[model samples]
Target: MENTVLIKNATVLPFTRQANGSLNLEPQIADVLIEGDRIAQVAPAIESAPPSASVIDAANHLLIPGFVNAHAHSMEILEKGNHEASPLELWMLYTYPPLQSQHLDARLCYLRTLIGAMEMVKYGGTTIQDDLLELPYVTPEIFDAVAQAYVDVGMRVSLSLHTINQPLHHTVPYLSDFLPADVKQDLEAAQGLSDDAWVDLFRQVYQKWQGYRGLVTTVLAPSASQRVTPDLMHRIATLSEEYDVPIHTHLLETKTQAITGPELYGESVVAYAKRHGILTHRTAIAHGVWLSTQDIELIAEAGATVIHNVVSNHRLCSGIAPIRELMDAGVNIALGSDGMSSNDSFNLFDVIKAAGLVHSAMDTSYDRYPKAADILKWATYGGARSALLHNEIGAIAPGMKADLVLYDLNTLSFTPRYQLPIHLVYAENGSSIRKVFINGQLVVDQGRVLTVNEADIVAELQDRLPEYAVHRKQILQQAERIRPAVEKMLSTAVSQSLSIHRFSRPLHYVS
Candidate 1:
């Protein structure tokens, strides 16, 4: 028998994309009916209820589609508040240093992922495109632990075997010239697992966990365009085609990357992706902060998505992305909080607020700024596109997956609310979220998770914090050996005179 649920007397944001590319977000008071894992109906009134249906009195509640965190790294949850803000390359040296040994046990992996998942659920996020990378390498045991964590939390994840085969210096610009011989030798000794080996590992993981329990799906992630060989990129493309899944990768996130793209590929990175048959509808490029006009056109023509990690962009000093230009060119845009190591939060509402406000500084014209409704759509529907689940989730309508969040309208965020969409974008944080449903299962209700012992997991992770802090200090001390070389590479890479500008000011600007 199919499980049924009926929610009564709630305000609904029935988000449906229209033919002209605008979202229909006209709010109305309605009742929602859920059967099994799909929305059965949404109407002004649901007159009859199924005999087996569980009912919830949702009076004075604001019902909306659950937010999708299109790009994130779940493993970085432990690194929150541990690192200082620096340029992308400099920060990565400590956060994901190649020389660090893999030290996390399988239980630690599970516990860390659970902390991230639980936070997202508490903040009204239902789906995450976890472009997850394990330091040094990924093992099947680690993969299973991560997947099990998501399933246990009752949230959705598009997990990727995100990795790179090229040497660390090869991926970063001017790194080879700056690294000392001893440091270079140390890095080479710590070279990653071979391309064939990772592919084999992914094949095993994909065969085991693709669409497991309707909560977890798999994607292929080559770390970036310049980070892998052309042959590996083609293989990744072919695998994506074979599995008919989305491909997630980093592209042009910093001015250093902007310089590296032309230096390595002899053209824009987007052009290189096109040459390798990687720019497609299934391709989602994270942090496209340095795209050119031509690059935007190619991505739009190929129907690729650019996930704007707005807060992380600013937090890492990567500079603002040309979001206004991307939106003008008809390219799909999604919002991501990035990893906790970078943005330090999983709250999509915070991301939505940032996405709405930050782009205004890029353009003086109010007309060109992102609309509140559009930003909300990017968080929901655009995120669904990034996950390749546009047809399945990201909306509140019949036949869509029953992933919804209900906010108490009586909350201060909605007090005397004038415009529903505007309040959602600017006023509301995660505090107003009273109930969250994923796959027709009420997993979070009134500030508590129903699926697992979140308090126990949080306690276990907290108990190990002192141990983890000691380990992090050791890693940072080891990383100090290479920090000067990385800083030199960053300075030299960003000093190059690229024709485009993503920085708030020109490279030569003096304070």
Candidate 2:
């Protein structure tokens, strides 16, 4: 960040909201001047540069604000592609046991997060909201290891502690009824961390690594509504108000979640969060896949942001989120790469395409579909808002932090290009990202990370993966033992009446 850098003659996509509330994806050719960690100016001609300024001749390049990934799970990078096409309930059972088993070493946790951050930076992602969980319980030392990984890899992160206090049998609707006594006993014994213990852990993390190297931040993440008690939610809300940090939560990722409210608490899950005083402008709700019209209105009124994880929703058989309705209701929409365990990739480029194309299938009206510009907006500035960095990182104007990316317009995806936004959303996969600058420091040049040793990191994982797989044998077996009962629990819950239909196919029509 010490040296000034000048990007010459790059075609830039300036994000602007239209008077009609639509996205304007207009491009302009300009030279960008970077002075230290912030943009100095952007114009047709930026004349004055110091002698040592780095010059990038971008004659035909697409310069965009580095992607702000609104949602992610860095801890799950090691567990990608582990679960095959399972719903949220079953997927949880499949993924969480190893963490509970205490077989995952702290070094493995660091490697997991480092590799994920590498992928994100390589794919032009500059910031992420990582809702990480340390199985069995969360500790400051273990959480700080993941934070150090992000710091070393040069990615801005909102490191959320995604811990659950409620027992397994109590997390879902009548899950205890299907499991045997031995399994029930196991669930009770493996309650992970207590509510108070988690609170102390959050305080420890907040004190130790909230703003390390100006890249890492913290968020209060109570795993989900059914998984965390109301009193704990209030505590988190109080902390949020005191610290003024972003609040992250998951709501209605599946049809079962959409019905959990009335069946358990006689309200919508969204209503339950609202009543607990958890909904606020600082709050970002992930996976609004099953939100009703009223729920959308409530979110709008609360000034909350709905994070759309399109890839995970589709991969897990979670139904499509109503982006059209949410946008129409004036709720700021953002995109996320949920977790490598579900998404299997940290590439926000693919997420953009999924966001662009998925909503069109639900509505026949062409105008109701998400525009390419709209999707790009979500990936950049909308995500900035989600991470509570909207004032700093998402835009490329003068005085903003110099987080930007240079994409090769010469690639086949952009070669013989039509509209830039359309091609970017429909075809690009981040392979053409030539350079990435975070805080005006060039961390990625020519498709490789410079901040960390990429080759050694990859080789280490390759060598250790087999040993890790052998170690995971027991945990996978335990997940298999509970899988059938959870499947039964899902079947039973699907029959409970709900006023909304989020799934593409109905299980059993009440009508």
Best by the lDDT measure: 1
TM, every model: 0.97, 0.96
Which runs of model 2 end up more than 4 angstroms from their true locations?
A: 16-24, 507-511
Residue pairs whose backbone atoms clash in candidate 2: none
Q: Write the per-residue lDDT of candidate 2 for residues 1-511, one digit (tens) a residue.
A: 3769999999987564568755557889999999988899999887898878989999899998989889888767888877687677778766677236563677777888889999999999999899987677666667878899988987888899886777777767767888888888877777567778887888888888887777888999988777788998899889899989888999988888876777789888889998887889999999998899989999999999999999999888888898999988989989999998899999999899999988888867997788888898899878888888888888778888889999999999898978999988998999889999998889899998999998898888888888778767777788887877777888888887777777787654221
- Judged by whole-model lDDT over C-alpha atoms, candidate 1 comes out at 0.88
lDDT of each: 0.88, 0.85
- Model 2, position 364: C-alpha lDDT score: 77
lDDT of 1 at 192: 75
